[model samples]
Target chain A: MSDSTLTVERVSLRIGTFALQDISFSLAPGQVYGILGPSGAGKSVLLETIAGFYWPDHGRILIEGRDVTRAAPEARRVGFMFQDYALFPHLTVAQNVKFGLQFRRSRPRPTEHSQVQDLLARLGLEQIAERHPSNLSGGEKQRVALARALAMEPAFFLFDEPLSALDARTRDSLREELRTLLRELGVPAIYVTHDQTEALVLADRLAVIRDGVLLQEGTPSEVFGAPVDEFVARFVGVETIIAGRVLCTHDGVATVQVTPERRIEAVDHGAVRSPSVLVCIRPEDVALNRPPAKDSAGANQFPGRVVGGEPLGPMLKVKLDCGFPLTAFVTKRTYLDLKLAPGAEVVAHIEAAAVHLIGQP
Target chain B: MRTQTLGQSRGLVFVFSVVGGLLLAFILVPLLRMYATQTPATLMQIAAIEDVQSAIWLSLEAAFLTALLAGALGVPLAYLLARTTFPGKGVVEAVVDLPLAIPHTVVGIALLFVFGRTGIIGGPVNAVTGFQFWGTWGGIVIAMLFVSVTYTVNAARVGFESVDARLERVARTLGAGPWSVFGRVTLPLAWRGIVTGLMLTYARSISEFGAVIILTYYPMTAPVKIYDLFLQSGLDESSAMAVLFLTASLAVFIILRHLSYGRVTPGGRRM
Candidate 1:
């Protein structure tokens, strides 16, 4: 019987200097839950404690209601894939995949052959099955590690930064592949990573951990689109969350007045029409135009002067003081065409659909 | 590949060869004298002595057993020293390798004092056990263990340290318990280096003279037998025993070293 639910309840473990304080979260079966945090955020420690490595200083871990806090890692029946993929160097891909299954004290031994073949094919490692880890590429090693973990038919999957060690290109592709693989197999998994983009793309729900404390956990939209606090809000993105009042509503869309006397409209939530409401928006949602000809149609416009602008890769993130100083994202090409400089008068036009009214105030 | 640098390289090579040749001369000349008196028939005849044969076998057994003890005790200590960081880690590490610098005779005397009848820890231990370690196979084992502990401890420590801790963490998350992870991932990877260390320790123990001489001069090992034969019989008998012991110990050492480095086929053929 496969357990689809992994519950970590108040698991507090202090490893060295980092202390995980009463961390708790539950993941539904077949969903990839990512533990996301900055470096030294106790993210890896949390994953390890749940996997039964570091004995929790307090609390219990329940896999579908059974307390496994004191259980051995192998006895816990969880599969852990590491950032380096940690393929056994001496073993071929086939042998590596068969490692966990071979240890089962069962009636019939799981043959090294078929289990290897099935998982290798599943992970597209069939052709490379006979090769050692040192011979495989990064993506290939990642797959081999995944294959090895999955071959055991584990109760839950634990991914400790599976894509963190890969080159950028491989990480991008493998993230999608890993998410798809977990989904297709319907294996409940807990993934830990510092890479926010990977968490955003791969996790069904994101648990934001910082300094060993779980700051928040929700669906990607819930965690990212509707973060809980100031740090989470900034970590999700460097944009601002504004508390404002719904000045008016037309055809179910309400305009909220923001700080620095700017009005923004979002697909209205009934609660948002109250005296105060909070709207979450990313810098990418705002576009800068030269004073949008006094009044723009089908757009929420606010006049602001560019205070700062920086080009980072394909996008230009500009700081604007449209009332409240805020950042707006545009293409580098767009920045150049608009000649967006500091103190430049620009109209910040926001798409109504992009203004995310997160939660009740 | 410039002419000036090539000339410098050649000059350096000449100097290195000269120094190496002198050192080889210093080592090989004395060894050649030890074997120079032997003829084939005399070698065969003297080597056929049963007492000398038994002593050599005893020495080999003692060395092998001692190496096994070192491997069992030293690997875990090495692992702890390598993977963990705690207060006085450096002090602990230095203490583990301290035997290497200490004279083996001092070790034998220390073992004797500790395990000797009226000695500090030895008195209680001997009284409790009623079994003697003095002049016994047990004493030989203790002597060899003391002398060779650094071999297994240092090499296996480096081996364990070479492994990424992240891998163990991964194994843990993979549902492998601490013990299983150690047995599966940690032990297997470090086995090669540990085997090499064990073989080297065995070689050193087998060839040891000073410690064995100090502790148990009886139930004579080959080195002891050779020394006794030199005093009692003469050079011919002593040289024969020496050659025999040397050949056997060297052969086993080479075989162990080869086994450590080379792959063995399932059918027992070393590749």
Candidate 2:
């Protein structure tokens, strides 16, 4: 009953032994909800179900407040872009775009002809409109698919790994254009991808799905900043997860004891019912240096030796065994300034907010 | 191992060439000799004869109709076999290829039992419509279709299989119905293979002798007529008929192959 553009309520489906259990989410107008997961995680299957390709075994699907769970794909008024861009191989580029336009049930707009032409021109496909899909490059095929979907003027768009088939160079260049285009359309979209970077770049809100289960859903920063479980923490690039026991909670902060003499302060996520919890920290959030000034107070600092350093482009991943293992990504300049080879002593500084608490171990 | 010089094996080459040459000549010599037996003037004269002209005309018409019928009935079945998994799919496929496995003469006799007058379905059909299949053009078409329909079905199946299923699903999301998706996406992409099937069906139908002779002999097809003439008149008359039929079949085959690649039209935009 919410006023979201699309709502999937308590959907469950079983295909053989694999089952998608109790998936529920809603999308507001003009919002892009990126479903990020690895391959075979039912990301594409969920998209297809929302588009009305398959009826869920349980639950309701609504588009713009109308229930369409049992409706056919064409009747659902949902535009879908497939992973491979699925442009009709026999049709010319113009014909492919015009295909959806021909099926519009409403009155013809005064500028119908100009609308298709404008889309082709907007996608930089005016010159290739006469050519068949077999003659198109990967990026061109993707644009053609987008144009075809847009021509339908559906209630919302569902994209399934739209850029996964493109080469790395084409994907990088097309990502920005696609982002701008989706924003300009001002319609709700659900973009599905297995690549975390793609999801982070394109999603307003994100959901990390795993093995047909909805693991986590929130804004990109919320999910990336504070993952709810170890699977998610690792999936989102949080390399350092320390097992700890919650010693106490005061105000909104909780002290989790990592070792016999060491303790770290983290924002107390209300779901921490158990005495034992996992302290999650991202490598990029930790700062590595010799030591802080005496005036700098209330900084979580630890002295450790650099066990290994691997250069990752402009940064270095420094592995340290400080009583327990910890990893930090330092800038190349920091790595060079420290001259810190193996067994070199260095201090790692972490702010109170940088340490995130996961309620479930 | 040492490499042998090209000129060092001239004697061995001569022996090999002589054997290969004889096999090639074995096929070409008979056909060439048949063609050379008729002067251009005699070929023209023989083509104008009433019996010869009618028999050739019947053969072409029946084959063309058979191809059209096969395409209409077989393409959908081919698509089904290509896309879906049914319980008896293997059995269905094996039956489609059964024509190729069995002898052509046995196929003729098999058709007789099913489509003959007083046969199972044929008896009821004749009783209701009063149109007999035996010794009629209907019989000839059925006979030709039984043996040649597989070529069309298998070709169309290959064509439909090559089309990615994602294309159809994408079309559906674009507001196209199932029929629209097939016509706009599946059929056109698979056109070349379907055309090849049609060509094979037509050629097989026209050249069918045993089946047509058994099912319908009154409205004589070209092959049956040529055989009859060979028995009554001589080799001269039959060879002249063979040359004429071969030339016509070749012309049609070449035209089909040429048109297959250039079927691009403004409407379909086929590649």
Candidate 3:
């Protein structure tokens, strides 16, 4: 790893009944490593352990090639943005931002004031500098928290659901703002959240955790597009998963018989070394077309009927019975263009590469 | 519908006012009657008495001293009780509240066993430095503190508890050491509770008569002196002193309450 990289090597921690088992990842500088998990999955615990709030039972956390497993949080030089923002309710915005400057012994006195001013200005918090936390709105508090943490000039940043407390509109805007801010600061950050959209948006690399185990880690697209297991597929919003028997393989494609009457072709990717497999397909990748379209010879296309659908914001989630149950997400414009409704005849078209196959024993 | 609700609420308010008014009159009637008994001239005469002045001074000094000392001693225990969970925490909390459960005389007697001139801590201390808690200002302070320290500890604990632990954790992450976090974030956030606790401690200490008389009668606090006058002279003579002391205590109490709940900005700075 580079000198600016943070590495957690086989770190294992057990708090009460929850155990983070042999979790390991490395984050390069200026990259945001997002940890995605459901509640009680030890995502926050892992972040806290990296921040030196908890010591791992085994393994080590190293920041910039220095072992910080046993260092105090202050000595670790890591800035943490808590889930609730955790602004000092008793301090104004400027005071809260300046709180850490007093403890920075290495920095000379002259630049600290201007540095705080610069951070406040950068976060657009100068106008609210005199306001107490209680008087500010949720988005204002979040920006102040970001400015405060950035003011510390930390070596690394740890954010625990920093936007979770805000309303949906605020959270969406702040997530983009946080991503831009993290990039500008050039600090490696571990953003932990259970929200998949947040992980997809903010994470340069993502890790999915469940029951304290690091299930998978990769680029957001890589993890979401091709999950390695059934749990991961489901967690990443792969709506169609079916047990299949691989009857044959050719040209990196496997013809898997999902049911006796239904056969599908999916990219093998050399992952289908076993006869038994699970066919995973993302809902968004499945396209619905009106019947009587030209079906390319031997292409993965099946005639189906729309069983039901519900409007999901601008997209419609259509349940299809294509000899087997499948789900497809289409835009409202397409739904209107096709005049899709319950019992509407449709053709489900899926690409070979979109069909991710996970090997089963 | 709004008229019906308003009518029902008016009837409820009438019932509440009747019971609350009776309770308020029960407390105020005797104090008002006593004030009416003494003219301004007679009350000034009693306040001019040197003995009464010294005794009132002593009471204020001892109570203020007790509050400061208890704050120094009790705040850390309060923080610990609020933040940590140890094996015997329940027992420790109960012990902190033991004085409040017991009578003041019992507290005085219990303190005497530890701080009396010939007692455990007092025996060695008296021999070493010729300092004695018995029949001294120290005796009065210890007696008052024993009975009133609970208020300080409990109030500060509630204050510390109201502060989010995450704030302290974030402070630590922001380059603050543990002590710096406590001073900057925890203490300031918990200040209102601590001040209120100290106010209550001071008020309770000033009114501590049972423990003070049992420990030391020579350095008479206002309450003990008033009792002494009531026993030696009669109702008329002591009542004047009582009214004077009552007025002084009320004035101080009201001022302290205002100071404790003063106009503090949301940032916790006093405005």
TM-score of each: 0.81, 0.91, 0.96
Query: In terms of TM-score, which candidate is strongest?
Result: 3
Candidate 1 per-residue C-alpha lDDT over A196-234 given as tens digits, one digit per residue, 9 for 90 to 100: 788888888889989998999889887886676667877
lDDT of each: 0.79, 0.86, 0.88
Q: List the residue pairs that clash in candidate 3.
A: none
Question: Can you give the lDDT of residue A182 in candidate 3?
Answer: 77
Model 2 lDDT on a 0 to 1 scale: 0.86
Native contacts present in each candidate (fraction)? 0.48, 0.69, 0.84
TM-score of chain B of each: 0.87, 0.86, 0.92
Q: In model 1, what are the clashing residue pairs, if there are any?
A: A4-A29, A73-B175, A74-B175, A80-B174, A260-A323, B114-B122
**Residue-wise C-alpha lDDT for candidate 3, range B1-271, written one tens digit per residue:** 3434434687777788799999999999998999888878877787888999999889888999999999999999999999999999999999989998898888788888989867899888999999999878999999999999999999999999999999999999999999999998899889888988999999999999988888888789999999998999878768998888878877888887787677564465564
**Candidate 1 residue lDDT tens string, B1-271:** 5434434687777788799999999998877888787788877887788888889999999999999999999999989988888899889888877888988778878877876666676577678887667768877877888888889898898888777777776666555667888998888777766887798789878977778777777788888899999999898878877888888998988887786667632122335
Summarize candidate 3's per-residue lDDT along A258-353 as a digit string, tens digits: 989889999877866899999998999998888865675657888899899998877899999999999999998899888788999988899998
Off by over 4 Å in 1: A1-4, A110-113, A240-281, A291-300, A303-311, A319-325, A332-345, A352-361, B1-57, B80-95, B113-136, B169-180, B225-247, B264-271
Give the per-residue lDDT digits (tens) of candidate 2, residues B142-240: 999999999999999998898888888988988989998889889987887788899899999999999889888888999999999899888877888
Worst 10 residues of 1 chain A by lDDT: A268-277
DockQ of 2: 0.47
**How would you order the candidates by DockQ, starting with the best?**
3, 2, 1
The best-first sequence of candidates by lDDT reads: 3, 2, 1
By TM-score rank, best first, the candidates go 3, 2, 1
Chain A alone, TM-score per model: 0.85, 0.93, 0.97
